[model samples]
Target: MAKTKEAAMRTKNLRGIVRLSALAGLAVGGLALAQEAPDRGIVHVGGDLYRAHNNAHNTVFLVTSEGIIVSDPINRDFAEWLQGELASMYDVPVRVVAYSHHHWDHASGGEVFADTAEVIGHETMPGALALPSGDTPLSDAAAALDANGNGQIEQSEASGNLAGQFALIDADGNGMLTGAEIARGPVSDVYPPSTVYSDTRTVTLGGKSVELIHVAAAHSPDMTVLRFPDEDAAFFVDIISLKRLPFMDFPGLEDVDSLIGTIQAVEAIDFSIGVGGHGDIGTKQDVADHRGYIEALRDAVAAGIADGQSLEELQASITMDEYSDWGSFNWLPNNIAGMYRILGGGN
Candidate 1:
């Protein structure tokens, strides 16, 4: 499909440049908002790390004597805006563009800093970006849009980033969307990480350090939980949005047990501040709370399944009212649907 070709070309081009730069003397490297809020600004996370936000979505960056390290471009415009901000605010160019995952909402617009930064991610990112076969998992929200239950998402069914992008994302112009198309969403282009790593890897510049931990996650297998030791802060994208209820069905979610494991992996990291891809800044306890929320949800859904309750029945039976104070509390229904699907509820 056209999406596959375009993605391959971008990855290939980046690899070529990175290789050439390495031989030439070693080279360089490299938003979304929640609530549809347009608020934008930068605040210190601690030490050399700072978070720049555009409404509900935010990205963390590290600045050092050598250069700057950034995560997620959010979108083309957001990237462009951030690039200009970096230029005016810092002497060094962006040297690294680290992705928390391959999700278009968090990882797109990387081209904005491609000239001066190295794109990096978990090794599995390249495979996830490939135009997927029909087997790609869908978030409950996205699946609901497949009104007819057909594998393909039609233009009329589209909303949010996929709306009006039917032509571009369709790739083959077949008036249908594959998992790849819907996943790519509204992004014009996404550059796969040229410098990929597995398990754990650390990127150092000047005198600062940033660590990336890859783990199995329901959101995306490519999830990279970032830890900035210097700042005592960690950046975990959609895998953990502290203080906020899980997004509609958390598209791409698959296994409950594995997702819990993913959270445990994050807990092992030693960071006081937890900077989620969305929501406000949080604390280490927030990470615990984050994990506890999932654990609670998993237990509820498992019991419902054991009782042979329907998805709707479980939704009503488990209000998750204890979390009513959290943002997007009403998404409990969709959240239940996802937990149900993964728990063998056959949602």
Candidate 2:
């Protein structure tokens, strides 16, 4: 019986991996095309669901007979193109604009859908929107990034220093940026959701049902998991980066315990496949492993703290060598330092 149970577990894991591979083909392809412009790529994920792979992030949309529901407009131009696609392909007006979180890169162009769509997000989203803007003035950052000193920010010039800032620098209507536009600087538009929910909000648009489950103060105060029960697909951002290391600053987590619990909770839900805000597709096993990664890091840091190690000592001692081949090894130290602070009760 024990052998049979072990075999069954292996089979379950294999089945999950196979399903993940099938649903994640485009998701992997989407990563290779990350260099392409935001409007350049659109991935159709069976039925009425589709994902647009933008420069830095992805915007997912579902088309039902009643109307359309989209998550994250990315930016103005990306949203305009997404809106245009819906018009051209399905000819259905947008009924809802759902935000996964309140980060500028993901939710900025929500105003584009304001005419027809009812924007919805977590209750904490408004507070994030109300925070001070991080946009740097064009003149202030231009001299540093404008290589030619031509009073404009060219793609070549911006390439070196402004990798993460391109989504904000495109002031002109054209998708590409120019030195002149760079001179204008970064921009931020906050479109707060008209509808806010505390825990979960289930909306049946057209014929499909999606659950926006709030995992607050994890990646952000308003991070939401967009779950499609019928499709068995869930979209989560920041906490799980698939095979890659998280983006930056300990994956920008506010609470480590909350993040771990959230991942475990998501794993318990009925989902065949999952996708992050910024990487390849994921499986239940992937989410479990990510949780393990965090737990292991926490334990390692906790042990170090118990040993009375210094922050720098902990950083050197607690190397997550198992995940050394992951995307962002440089940020491992940052993760350790942050975890040390959390486990050590340091301010």
Candidate 3:
């Protein structure tokens, strides 16, 4: 009886282990399916132009006549989705991709479109990418978790694989980066652009004129805004987004007032519509809203300085609740800090 009882217990334990294994397998399969699902939030803007909000940090623009032009491709998954969407709209291939700045959220995904499309950026963009200050935490974690363990992080990782995606910078010089390192780098993937412009450049595709305008540093030193004059549509990449806070961690914060002025300069130009790097395409009001947010933050920081408040105090006191609903809130705190630094306080 004792032997029979012991055998029965062992059999029951084996069954339990098998059941657990099956459950684990099912869970993993479900996750894989979720990852492989089709892209959501792809929308049409009028006449051959499509805008896709891949998530919070990337926005892609597709022009059927002239192929596709992306403001900032955040990751490989997003890049793939963008390409697929363009293909669905136009039989022709994507011709060009323009980087808003050298930041990873705007540039890392270039590998996806880089192979086929002409990846373009400002004259200083290549140098910025080579520097080690534009990495992000979410990117680092994803890189660590990739199947092959390469340092390249993808969008899927930023969305689900990781708990939160935070902008990070790399202070250390090691080629292998930590999440912190990625957040600190100025730009990643510094490939030579097919075309580099100092002030402005124009490319005509399918009889449509696409103008790449270099707006003086508001978010980053090499910020570029793309305009489709005939379409009356403009893409203000990184300068603004829908619900998230704009990132102001670049070197241009010293001239916050000038940055706002530069944005106003763009506003003076007549354009019926504008698209941000991370949000929906809308009227010039979108541009004005972004400017307002920046101007408000600058004023708040300046007020804090007048009050003799420390950097930490200023950061805590300034609130972006009015603009919180705008995309990129994850990056707002950093923007505040950047402003504080520009105002002569360091933390």
The models' CA-based lDDT, in order, is 0.78, 0.70, 0.63
* Candidate 3 off by > 4 Å: 1-40, 131-190, 242-244, 248-252, 309-338, 345-347
Taking the tens digit of each residue's C-alpha lDDT, what string does model 1 give over 1-347? 12356655654554443244334332222111221336688998888889998767899999999999999888655888999999999999999999998876788778768778889989988887776565776667778799898877876687765653444355445567777667655333566677899999999999888998887766787889889987889998887788998788866667766777877778888899999899779997887787888889989999988888888889889987788888888889999888787777853
Residue 233, candidate 1: Cα error in Å is: 1.1
lDDT: which candidate is best? 1
Off by over 4 Å in 1: 1-37, 132-163, 167-188
The TM-score obtained by model 2 is 0.68
Q: Please identify which of the two predictions, 1 or 2, would achieve the higher TM-score against the true structure.
A: 1
Q: Which stretches of candidate 2 lie over 4 Å from their true place?
A: 1-40, 131-188, 251-254, 345-347
Candidate numbers sorted by TM-score from highest down: 1, 2, 3
Q: lDDT tens digits, residues 70-177, model 3?
A: 667665456767778677867777778887777666666565566567778899876665544444344534565655455544323333313222122222222234
What are the TM-scores, per candidate, against the unseen true structure? 0.76, 0.68, 0.65
Q: Taking the candidates one at a time, how many backbone clashes does each contain?
A: 17, 3, 29
Candidate 1 C-alpha error for residue 304, in Å:
3.0
Candidates 2 and 3 compared: the better one by lDDT is 2
Candidate 3 residue-wise lDDT at 59 = 61
